[model samples]
Target: MTEKTAGKSLGVVGLAVFLSAALGYPVLIVAGRGLNPADGAVFLAFWGVVFGIGSALSPIEQEVSRLSAHADLRGGRVGPTALRTVAVAVIAVGVLGAVLALPPVAERIYSADDISLGLIALASSVAFALQFGTRGVLIGFREVKPYGGLLVTEAGVRILLLCALLVLGVTGLLPISVSVALGSFAFLPFLVKARKHVDFVGDAEPWSVVARRTLLLMLSAGLTASVLTGYPAVAKFFAAKEDLDALGSLFFALSLARVPLLLLSPVQAMAVPTVVRLLQDEDGHRRLVSLLIRGTLAAFVLAGLGGLAGWLIGPWGVRLLFGDQHVVAGWAVAGLVWSSVLLGAVLLLAAVLVARKQPGRVLLTWAVVAAMSVLVLAFTPGDMVLRSVFGLVVAPTVGVFVALGLVVRAGSRDTSVTG
Candidate 1:
């Protein structure tokens, strides 16, 4: 019965992850097929900023909900006071994003046309916050199926609209931006579903404690999320117009390489709740150690298999999907695939850390990674496009090491105590 319950839970999570990734993978393929290289660069760049904002808000969304649900299960709740705090935090972030999207600031991040679309995309960040916040509530309430459905609906709307635009020959940043904004609202229906979950976190910890923790996590983990989503834009800024096509092609390859993340993202929603629950039990640490080890192994295996697949057909894929200008070197594709494997491991490790209530380690990991990436972009003298791509490949190794160290330390700590 225990094994069966675990299996059923695994099956449900697996379904959600794959289903969430469905539209995303296809969207990348369709965009590659339809958009010109330069436009692809614009689209990818705009995507970085918008999604970065969304990712930034995700800590609040996922944590608040997970905590809310966890509290409820423990005879506590987040309550009206904390919920209001969440609201205030959302508004504050939204304002900041809006200000950053203004003309002067926008120019720093994008071309004039791209800036226009970037602003529109930024507008969608509010919707993103609302959607994710609600999702956290649903997650906390253990409405897993509904939570997963909302995930699919949000992504589905964007991809369907993008496909329609592609069919009509509207392959540019504007179409992409509009699709993002529209799709963000697709989760409105789920907000109501989450209402009961958010009603009152009974006997929960102090709102101040949760608020402080949420803010800290948002700053640390959010920064990492921002870098992952925003690097393409930053890379584009460093690249000359002559190099746009190459950057675009590299990004196209990156999108495919990161297909694993798309699959793992929703699956990770279960991580916090599961880890938190497990950690409270007598065998919590052992269970967490086992899960982390196996998950990391699985991530590495997938990386190897995915890398081999990429090496074989990656160049052919680029040419077929995005024309000859999009040809990626086989070695580069292989490196990126392995890097993605590292990335998946990093994400898993991050969840482990989060579950253990240690976000500082996650921040340290990203700080090192972000510094390396920025230095490479700013000072690595070479073809701008090539250098940026190299940085992307190298940065994940740092995460791998840091995550490995934490895993070992955690295991040792648990063993010393248990033994």
Candidate 2:
């Protein structure tokens, strides 16, 4: 992909992500108003699982596209082997979701009474995993427009269905759960043309090589995602019922913080394909460095603006939208906004590292950050909200420095390599 096309693809995908959020945020707002504080917490806790599951499984889509994109750059066809491999990864994620919902394991993460929601969450998860793989193929093919369409299809379907359900006076967990599970099936239409492919066994890259990369990215994606969405689960497990409302606020703000990060994720994901293709140019590493500097500046500028907005308006907005009863800790919102800012930088760094075939650098960054997240959560003693704020704030502070060091190292290494 040329630099011009790369910028355009990033814009299109990022806009689609924003539009999806616009369509879906109303449902969340209505739920916050309609449900009582306690029920809203319960609802959010389950809703968190739905999204968290999707986040965990997204590596298959990313890695599939990454591998296929390299092949495309090399003037080779993306074989069915990549597709078939992604299918297994999707299935494995489904099984992992199921296993986590089992009695003993489930007890550790979520309340057992949520078992029915857990089961429904599993179905939603599988559907989303499948959806992600299909979308991944489009990305690998560099089918940017179609990729944006698939994103719209699911979120659009959910909004329409959810609106209908609200009009029918259906409220509570059932509507949200049902809408999400069904919305994920919108990925079906995009998959129709993806299936009719013959494997070029002669041109086939070894599955093990592809699988190794896939596995590495999968673990990296999963860990990075856990750092993003796993906190609600931690709060669900360890936080007292009295602390649930504050946890609810944390989750809600985290979801808001997620918007820019999720929007940024597609841009980051596109980098592996786009940047690798750019490496063929004589000034490739220069182009790569320029991309990194631009991306970092863009990410920070947006994050700073977002944090400023959140600091100014987030508390009032949270209550107004979700409900007066829903707790909104102003500082927590600020902290989360900045945390997500740091996360955006981490994501861009990871994408560049992956494009450089330095997934290990990205992997180590996430491992250390994930550990920081865990340690802060485990050792802290205070109000749940303060603990959450502290943990969320501190980990990402650690992340930004770690990410910067690795990014610089990778850039220096690439300079030597290309020279």
lDDT of each: 0.71, 0.72
TM per model?
0.82, 0.82
Candidate 1 per-residue C-alpha lDDT over 47-124 given as tens digits, one digit per residue, 9 for 90 to 100: 777777677777777666766766677665446654754665577567767776777656545655335675576668
Q: Ten-residue segment with the worst summed lDDT in candidate 1?
A: 410-419
Q: How accurate is candidate 1 locally (lDDT)?
A: 0.71
Q: Top lDDT: which candidate number?
A: 2
Which residue pairs come into collision in candidate 2?
none
lDDT of 2 at 316: 83
Shift in Å, residue 12, candidate 1? 3.8
Clashing pairs in 1: 65-136, 76-202, 77-201, 77-202, 78-201, 79-201
Candidate 2: tens digits of C-alpha lDDT, residues 1-419: 78999889888988887787677787677777776665566666666677766777777776667767777687766676676666666666678778867876565454454566667777878888788777777778778888889888888898888788789988776676677668778888887655432244545557677667566667777777667766677556666667766677667767776676766756665667887777778777766777676767776677677778888888887787777876676677887887888787887777767677676777888888878877887789888778777777787768766876776655443522421
